[model samples]
Target: MNFAFSLPLALAAALLDVTVGYPQAVYRAIGHPVTWMGAFVAALESRLNRPTLAFEVGRASGVFALALYLGAVGVVAGLVSSLAPSGVVGFAALALLASSLPAQQSLDRHVLAVARGLEQGGLAAGRSAVAKIVGRNPETLDEAGVARAALESLAENFSDGVVAPLFWIALGGVTGGALYKAVNTADSMIGHKTERFLAFGWAAARLDDLVNLPASRLAALWLIAAAAVTPDASAREAWLTVARDAGRHRSPNAGWPEAAIAGALGLKLAGPRVYGDRLVDDAFMGAGRREADAADIIRALKLYRASCVIQALALAGAALIAQA
Candidate 1:
């Protein structure tokens, strides 16, 4: 991809996502690209992740499956970029396509529903709403647990769904962004240590971590800066928590943004949690109150929005610099 063209294209896509997001109408009409990737991954997993298969065979099949998925997504995005005129019209077209990949508005909307549910209907309502966003077993979650799940999901998705795509688009244009989404989709679908996916998801999980490293760190920085301006959010606490607790989470990359949000909002996150029948004994991320409420979810959303603004300004500045 041309660096000059992609720089502004990334900025434009970010702005467009913040402004309009992916419309539900469009999603209903053609379905989102991420969902399409998820369908493909699910099909591959069902076909390749046979319980009778040897572990090494499953692992090799997984690697090949992911490579195929990435190659297909990259080729399609490359075609989109190549077919367009390398002019204002082309940039706009690419930016519009790129906008569908990011999840700023979609994330905020889902998180907000959880907060609203908690406020209006208490734990049961919150659990129902939060279930839509988190993978954990929400059946046993209390009000605080539901709220914490929402906040954590907001932070983690902020990294994977927003910053990661922006990072890739700046470096590799629409193809890069789509490829990241494909990998992320695979990881979410199959990258589990469970009996079913332990071998089949190894490649997806590792590659997702590698690609998200830079974006996750940048997400931490954005959270720290956003904390400086957001009410009830501590920039110092964000930095300290990230330094102290980011390495504590199970994921190599998810911890950065989760810890940053935890410290910024003065709420602890990511302690022992239940996913299906298994329990994950994850370390706490912040040394603050453990009982998160709807108010805390709102505060996290504030920090998330602020972080997005920081990302946008930085990308826009870079685009301007490239033009100069």
Candidate 2:
């Protein structure tokens, strides 16, 4: 599929996801696309990423594993896309499936849960809620830390979970979105600097970075626009942060949205933090305050919601132009 058709398809998918997110009952019954991809990633890593392999061999195995995973995802998505009937009915059906690719509603729910946890249950509750979404050790966090982590996750996932899939679907249909999700899942599961994954996950990590490039930048712009319209947010600060500090983060892509939102919301993010037992010394994304709280989380959520609206409008506008 090309942009002419794919743009509306993506717009429809985004609308569906935002209005009617994947039902919990459905998720419990069939799991998610990401989970399905995770199972495949685990199996491949278990089989191909043997501990006995040399570094070069393991790296090669990683490349092959990534190829296999993406190939399988593409084929499955293509087959599923084909099952839809021709015309508008088929487009609706495909959009329904593609809706699962983006997590706008779910991300909002999860982050909002953190804000509620902080407001209602204090630091411990905040930690519990944030732990569900963040990889960092929850116990290490105070209320401020928990809030910051949640906001950081919100910004980063806005790029990965929402923008990335829509971007791919607008380019290559649901198959492309599924492929991007698979690569992202592979990176999450096995892409690490640990001894076991350093070599075996290199390809997945690198490719994830590469594929996310456009979406990451776009997500930042979406946030910048959101800030411009948001009452309390500073669009100028968002732009300035993205220009100055987005490149400072260790991650090649995550810094874009994080910096924009952090500056827009007047908060610091992605500074030195602990994940599990490791204390990763990363550069800060914005020169804003570090002591954020539940109110700040709410502000960030406002921006996130605004950004989603912006994304939908962009999709609609692009589709209209394409049709014309």
Candidate 3:
């Protein structure tokens, strides 16, 4: 529960996730932790966010629902961690549970699919593959747009899907990680400025933003460092882009990693994009070429993989220091 134990636990979990991703068989049998959390989120939105309630009342209900979700996940994870036997077996069990938190392997698979689709198939294939990861409308995207969307998703998710969970685990062990994931799931499900979610999901959105603040910065650093060593990446551009253009992003935290990757790879990202009928006119990050392609996705994937190694090594170092 403390750093002495939790640091090593997190290191183990990250390694397991990288090497042995959550298997298809296991997922098919019981679904993943995130899926279970999604179901709970859906049920809460249905039961609590009623149209009949006043805006304030619905908002208050949403806050209460978020509290309930976090409480449930945290308590269960805490119990499991507490009841685990001492030594390797206990740590292994905890690692197995924690492995479910990071979606690194799955993220890689999803991004790679986009790259393959572009390389092997065509624009339609690329759009179909990118559609799975991004909320943007895929029908209108060209090949370059599809590649950009995939790369953008990779950078943002590297922070939310991988780094954020590890950050919480290092702080509060199983309980902390579980609670962070629950809140993040809530944000993804209902956190938006849309009429339906703007008021009702304010608390979840704000909390997710707060928890992700530090991790988002840390993720930026990871990418910058990884870029310094990568063959085609520009570390200087990454740092400059992050500093200059990250703030231009609509989401306070998402722009950091996205801008870093954009600068590192010398590609422009986050320009005008469509979501359904809505056109989001976001400022561009990284003043580089806007014509991204399948090759660019491969480069982004390399940067992503290198960043993962850096993160794992950093966590392992922290664990050793904690033990010392």
Candidate 4:
């Protein structure tokens, strides 16, 4: 499709990622972008997030630290973007770099592995496979719990890991995508309520919330559309579920996709769950069956994959229209 540069860049990167995900060899060679960013975030936190500092002082330092790091990442991405020549090779190289930010293929593989583990070995295998993707305590999970956890992680991350980064890239190209990844990495690492990070993670958490706003809503809509086409999935219920339950989620962004997927598949997700001995009694997203199984995980994967296709098509359409 002949499209404008801004959106085309994101579309190209997304297509590239869907075609071939980040390579294991490349990761071993230089590490992934998020990991590299995490190293920087860890160093900055060690130096800036002092326990001796008072609450507000630590918070201000967090703001400063976030600004410093995000600024550095943005500058670097921009430099790389500028250095690329104005032709096919340069464009391909930039798109390749941008492709690393979205994890559509990997998310599918991880979530699917949970299904395979359940199918092949049972609860222990399911838990083991799921643990790679979710942060909740795997030992506390039963078969249903493992399935729910896997599906929940799949739904939530589809928004965060795939849609949000692509949304930024569609708007601002590689630098924008890189900046979002930096903020997200910071949030994942430090955005905790513990005494150690409650204040220090404020900026990262807040900004992540802001950047993810539009994508979350858009993601829900796409999931709803996906539900319409998938067998036995309820598009009507998906819309109703999102309208009724999306806001009930603890996260501003995660609930949208989670609720849509829950309603589409007629399953309950993200209810009470254990996270490192802490029980988070969050509201359930769908008023459907709580006894989710590997089959349901497969169902959710169908919806997730459909949603990805729908989103990519939407971006392509938007780009074509913009260029026209």
RMSD values, in order shown: 1.1, 0.9, 1.0, 1.6
Estimated TM-score for each candidate:
0.97, 0.98, 0.98, 0.98
Runs in model 2 lying further than 4 Å from the true structure:
none
* Model 1 lDDT per residue over 1-324, tens place: 667778888889999998999888999999988889899888888877775689999899989888888888889888987898967888888899999888899999999999999999988899999999999999979899999999989989999999999999999999999998998899999988888888889999999999999999999999999999998899999999999999989989889999999999888999899999888999999999999999999999999999999999999888888888
Q: lDDT tens digits, residues 142-242, model 2? A: 99999999999999999999999999999989898889899888999998889899999999999999999999999999999999999899999999999
**The CA-based lDDT of model 1 is what?**
0.91
lDDT measured at residue 313 in model 4 versus the true structure, 0 to 100: 92
On lDDT, the candidate that comes out on top is 2
Please list the C-alpha lDDT of all candidates, in the order they appear: 0.91, 0.94, 0.92, 0.92
* Runs off by more than 4 Å, candidate 1: none
For model 1, name the residue pairs that clash. none
Comparison by lDDT, 1 against 4, better one: 4
Answer with 2 or 3, whichever has the higher lDDT.
2
Give the RMSD in angstroms, all C-alphas superposed, for model 2: 0.9
Off by over 4 Å in 3: none
